[model samples]
Target: MRVLIVGAGSAGLTCAWRLAREPSTEVVLIDAGVDPGPDVPSFLLRDMVLPPPFYWDYAEFDRGYFLPRGKLFGGTSAVNATAAVRGHPWCYDAWGSPSWRWERCLPSFRAIEADMQFGAEPYHGHAGPVPITRCELGGFDHALGDAYVRRGLARIADHNAPGHLGFGPFPTNRIGDDRASTLRTLLPELRGRPNVTLRPQTEAVRVVMAHGEARGVLVRTAQGDEQLLEADRVVLSGGTFGSPEMLFASGIGPADGLRTAGLPVHVDAPEVGANLVDHPYVQMGIEVSDPAKPAAPPGKGALLTFELDGPGHLQAHAFAYRTRAVDPSADPCSAAVTCALLTPESRGRLELGTGRARVRLNHLSSDVDARRMAEIVARVADVVADLASEGALRLPADPWWHADDLPAACRREVVTYHHPVGTCRMGSDTASVVDEALRVRGVERLMVADASVMPSLPRGQTNLGAMMIGHRAAEFLLEAPPP
Candidate 1:
């Protein structure tokens, strides 16, 4: 059987790798951008950590804040900060399906990571392609992370351990001197394997549907030639924005929206480009005067987790280095802490623009979110006060920090964590675009295996979760009877 998988990102790579092992099944993986192969120079590795060539440049409706999505083989996992955080267990339980419970998802999670610090533990896997390393901080920075441990929070060296709630080193998907991108790890392992074709610079424009079944996809090849590729099954791993936009362009999605865009409606899936969610983030700058002889650390460390009302409600990620030039004369060292509301009540939407995907990230649109940010900021102020006493960290009494109207400040200061999910939500409900098995409703041999299918947001970074979705998709397809 021939299967076509569009988008060679985190999820797509994982799914394609699993299917390529079956000699009876032919797997074709396609992406829109160039891969640059495994010969990336070490000098340029740090620059590669930031989004550039593969990023899809998007912006908020009014704020014009940049929103980027990786558009290449490894996708965002290749460009992200290498954070490997698995959210609190309740994050999965909230999905309301046993198939997606934390217990069920943990095995896939284990199967994907080779945790350096916790490989022998029952929860972590030691043989996966992805190398998970624990971040360790030296010097004075260790004192700061330890302060939280003293505050009665559970001391957890392993962030994935049961009841992990305190501050320590962050687990990252980095292998020694390099980032563990799927192309560098998983894809390389599948190279030269039979029954697998990996093509870059090939864009999938739309899914070809016939009699309510997915037959194949129409594509624009690297040479700018348009072509049709047929397959017995098709999976859309194009991601949060790409998946929904592909659906909209393929004669699916809301009838009104499709008609207005001069496209014929097929399935009339209204939820195709709706229910967008992201963590609302706030970055606070800190300055340290040299004359004060403040203790400064060398390496970055720790993402402190907290519970405001319930599990994994909020998080604080802080860096020890300077972010901006505070004063030119003194050349004071500066640092920053990023705080975010994890379980946001706000919802956003994605629309197809003339040149790009238009996003209306209606951040802080809910009263519950406003209150949560307010409370989170207040708690931060208290923590900053204690840290500032030794002159190591200076939390300036900025207008936003001292403002009496905090709710209004929250509205203005909110930014995305870039963890968008739910564009093509999955569930058993009729309104959902896909079922519990991730098969698209009203379509045969079609599935969505990306962050877009998340019914609700996971209360942490989404790269690991997205990879697991790809693993699950492959299992479902393998277990099903062939068409």
Candidate 2:
């Protein structure tokens, strides 16, 4: 059987890796970005954000702020900070589907990572393609961790340990100084496989539909030539933004919106680009008390995940890193404490546009989210203030956290965590875009296996979660009896 998978990011690559191993399967994987080849730049592996020509030119969502998504071979997994967190068990249990519960999803998580720190644990796999490690804490990270411990939060040795949370060295997928993205791990294994074809610089224009089923895909080559790639099965692993855009391009979205865009409707799946959710964050800049003290190297250093005492258990993440990590032009002595609302009530939507797709992230629109995010900022600021008293760092003269209208300040300064999901929501009901098995509703021979299908955002970084989804997608396809 021939299978066509769209997008070569974390999910697409993982799905391809597993599916190509089947003797009866022939896999064709297409990506819009250029291949990374054998060697990727060492700097890209260290930095959380990547340079231009590597990202799609999506329009800025807010004032002078644009979301960055990797458009290359390994997709975001190659470009993102190698954070390999699995989030809390409650995250998966909240998906409302038994198939995606933490108990059901642990195996895939284990199968995908070779955890250096916890390999001996039954929950972690030691022989997976990707290698996971934790960074040793720098001086500032050590100080900040101590502050959290002073506040009575347990010092967690392993954040990826199921349901465990506290301040600790951030989990990352890396080998020494280099990144362990799919390009560096799975791609090497897939490169010489006879049954797998990797097509880079190829864009999926639309999934060709006939008799209410996906017949194939019409793709445009980098040189402008367009052709049909026929296959027995088509999987949309194009990611949160790209996957829904593909659905809209294929006229599988809301019929009214498709007709308005001058496209014929294939399926009236209204939720194609709805239910957009992401972590909304605001930062508190810090200045080193002594300029002579060397700043921590750029990129993620340490993380603190905790839940406030509340009804919904307001989940939040506090990351301490050099300001230059996110902005090269920023001050070398400057640092930042970013507070993000992990479980937000506010929902956004993406709409098809004449040019690029319109992404409206109504972040912090919900009162609860705004209030809770403000509380997080205030709480973390207090901790930082304690450090400042000890001559660690200096806060802004007019701190945003000090504003009388704290929630208002949060709304004015909110930024994306760059982890968008739920655009092509998956569930057990007909209203969901994809079913529990990851198959698109109202269509046959078509499936979506990426972050787009997440019903809700996981409580942590999504790269690991997306890869797990890919691993499971291939499992679902292979274990099923032949059609």
> In lDDT terms, which candidate is top?
2
Give candidate 1 regions above 4 Å deviation.
Answer: 48-51, 288-300, 310-332, 397-399
Instruction: Give candidate 2 misplaced runs (Cα > 4 Å).
Output: 47-49, 60-64, 291-300
TM-score per prediction, in order, is: 0.93, 0.97
Question: For residues 1-483, what per-residue lDDT tens digits would candidate 2 score against the true structure?
Answer: 788999999999999999988868999999999887877777666666677988877754555467688888888888777777778788888899999999888889988999998999988889899999987776688778788989998888888887787888788888887778887889888888999999999999999989988989999998999999998889999888899999999989999999999988989999999999989988888887766653455334788899977875568999777777668898878988889999999998889887778887889999989999998998898898998999888888888788999999999999888888999999998999999999999889899999989998888889989999999999998877237
lDDT of 1 by residue, 323-442 (tens): 432222434466556678878889998886676678887888998888888887777666666777865566676637667988788788888878999999988789999999998888
Please give the lDDT score at residue 3 for candidate 2. 86
Error of 1 at 53 (Å): 2.6
Worst 10 residues of 2 by lDDT: 291-300
| Model 2 collision count | 0
